[model samples]
Target: MKPASSSLFALAAAALHAALIALAINGLRAGQHNVPPRRPAQVQVQLLREQPKAAEKSPATPVQPEPLPQRPVHEHKPRTIPKPKPQPREQPAAPAKTPEAPAPTAQPSPDAAPAPARSNNTAPPAPAATAPAAPVKRGVFVDPTYLATETEKWYPRQAKRYGDQGTVLLHVTVSPAGRAEKVELKKGSGYPLLDTAAIDLAKSITYRPATLDGKPVSDSFNLPVTFQLHD
Candidate 1:
């Protein structure tokens, strides 16, 4: 009996140990099933990078200016004038006249009587008649001897040189005293020297007085003087 009993006891202990291990394995499988199921692990990814933003712009306004000043103006007027004067006129003149003449008178005859004088005494007196004169007597030479001698002496020497010969006639007046009062050349000799010599000779001659009614009186007569040239 004792051996049997010990062997049975050992066997029982070994079976109790196998039973505890099977219980621990079933507890681990149950805890695993109770835990939630795990979502697939999440992964985030970017294709482009992010860019910075730009600034905004506003509008502008316009300005204005001021004005200037001004000036003034003037005016004028007009004038006047005058006029002229007048003049005068003129006139004319006249004419003149003339006068007249007188008449003629008659002459008286010699046989008619003398007319009585008018008291007014306007006529002139008649002249008286006179007597006739006595005739003159011519004179003669008292002495003809002097005539011949004086002529030869008084002959001009110039007349003789030229062979000149001529006769000069003289008018002689005699006084009652038997003297020659005047001697005038009645005719001239062709030669002047002979004529001048004859005039001188006539002045020197003597005469017999003429008798008027038987009384000695003054008288005139012609006388001739001759000049001759000789060799």
Candidate 2:
């Protein structure tokens, strides 16, 4: 319990605390040296490019094969042969007959010829007479006044309006009684109206019958009718 012993104990406690602090600082420095220095933090960087998409393929069309040509079929026909004909047999000929001889004529008397000599001077027979031929008749006669009157009466109105003008040939048959039996057109004009008018005029006109040997007879003759415009 003395003052000096107390003071020594205090100094020993202070020295132990300082020694522990110093040991701790040295351990910290040793740990730092043992760890390797950290290289700057390394970041791995890789460039990425997008790959292009593959092109789509179209479906292929199926090919059709062509058909082969066919050969034509032919039909065969059988041939026919003709048979030969038989020959005809020959015949024997008949014998010919002989002709008979002609008979002799009797002689004429001398007295019969003396009677014929007297007729040598007789006159020749008279000549036969021939009748004279009759006069030939001419063609039928048609009056000009009658033709003009019939033409004026039967003129077609349509033909006059169109100024149609042409001639028409006609064959007219006359009876023995001086009457028109038949009429036919032989040739035509270019205008149908004028041709029709001419035919009508010919049918209405009367003709004198033709005469042969002073007798009236039926006859046919060609007649021409003209349709001419007046003004």
Candidate 3:
């Protein structure tokens, strides 16, 4: 190669190296002067727990005054009653007098008679014999025959089927209408069925009412009912 060409090449390389060094220095200076972006400040938050509020009281209602009673209106004037006329005075009458009776006179006594001799003659008439009065019927008003018939008619069918036989005595109160008012067991039968049947029969019985001066009256009497089983 020629000396001039080499010198020119060397000068161009030196100029290129100097330009690179200057660019590197400029980049370093720009990095040193540039500042980083500022970070935002951190804020501290404190949460507070709120307490629940109490319920508010409602307002009270105002009291109303009661209405006054209305007075009666006086449209017309009151009526005035007139005084009565005076009555005339009457004179009293005189009383009449009663007459007196006359007095009775006194009588004189007679003289005694003489005794006479005994003699046989007609005998004095004998007093007529009087028949004895019939005995007055009293006390028990019911007839025995009628009571027997009623007791037989009211015989219980159950007692007959079971062949139960007994006699029950009952005290019964009879009303004025001859109807039995109350019946109490004076003597119960041996069997309960017989006793119950007898009581029912006695209650249903009607008797002849007792009489006071021929008028009917209530009376109590002992009644007997026979519950006998017969073929």
Candidate 4:
């Protein structure tokens, strides 16, 4: 009997030990398992956006310049001139001289009216040369008183004495008033009585004075009056 009784107590102890171990292991497992507080799933967002990558700076544009201003205008003017001068005048000229004329020649006389016969007694001129002009004769004039009273005739006594025709040449110079100025006898008729008779008769005769260009001139005249006893 005693031994069975010991085995039944041992079995009861073992069951009690196993029960404690089981309780301790269950308490340890419960303590190791921790449950955090369950919150709703919350969404979180960043307040500032991340900065965008910086954009590349574009190249800068160039600028253009402006232009200048214009100027203003005005007016023009004219000019002046000069003057001229005057001239002088001229004169005239003189005249020339003239020449003289030559002399004319004489004409021949007619024989129908007979020239009174004469005896010339003047001497002839000398040479062949130019001579002075000839004297001109005067118109009809006479001294009647001298012509009548003093004339005389010739005689045969003189003719007989000379035995030739008697030449009684008387040289009588007359005055400007027609009176005999002087008488000269060149021959005595070869007889003195007849020569004296001839001279005395000639001294009383008168003649018209010789004239040259109408002026009375004094000159000598010689005449021979023949006394012939026969015709």
What are the Cα lDDT values of the candidates? 0.72, 0.75, 0.74, 0.61
Model 4 per-residue lDDT tens digits across residues 1-231: 356556666666776677667766666666678534233333332234334557978867756555556555555455455554555555455455456566666555665576688769868888798787787966324443443333334343545566554457788887888777888987656656656666766665556788888898887777554544444
TM-score of each: 0.38, 0.43, 0.39, 0.32
Q: Which stretches of candidate 4 lie over 4 Å from their true place?
A: 1-165
Candidate 1 error regions (>4 Å): 1-138
**Residue 77 Cα positional deviation in candidate 3, in Å, after optimal superposition:** 99
Evaluate model 2: give its lDDT.
0.75
Comparing 3 with 4 on lDDT, the higher-scoring candidate is 3
Q: List the residue pairs that clash in candidate 1.
A: none
Worst 10 residues of 4 by lDDT: 37-46
Residues 48-83, candidate 3: write the lDDT tens digits. 334455777788888988989999997988888888
Better of 1 and 2 by lDDT: 2
Residue range 36-133, candidate 1, lDDT tens digits: 43433333222232233354444444444454454454454544445445444444444454444545566777889997776976677777776777
> TM-score ranking from best to worst?
2, 3, 1, 4
lDDT of 2 by residue, 1-231 (tens): 456656666666676666666666766766788854343333333323334547767778878789879888777677776776776866666666667666667667766564444757889999888788877886788987788677777778888887777888988888887777888889999888877787777777778889998799999899888777786
**2 or 4, which is superior by TM-score?**
2
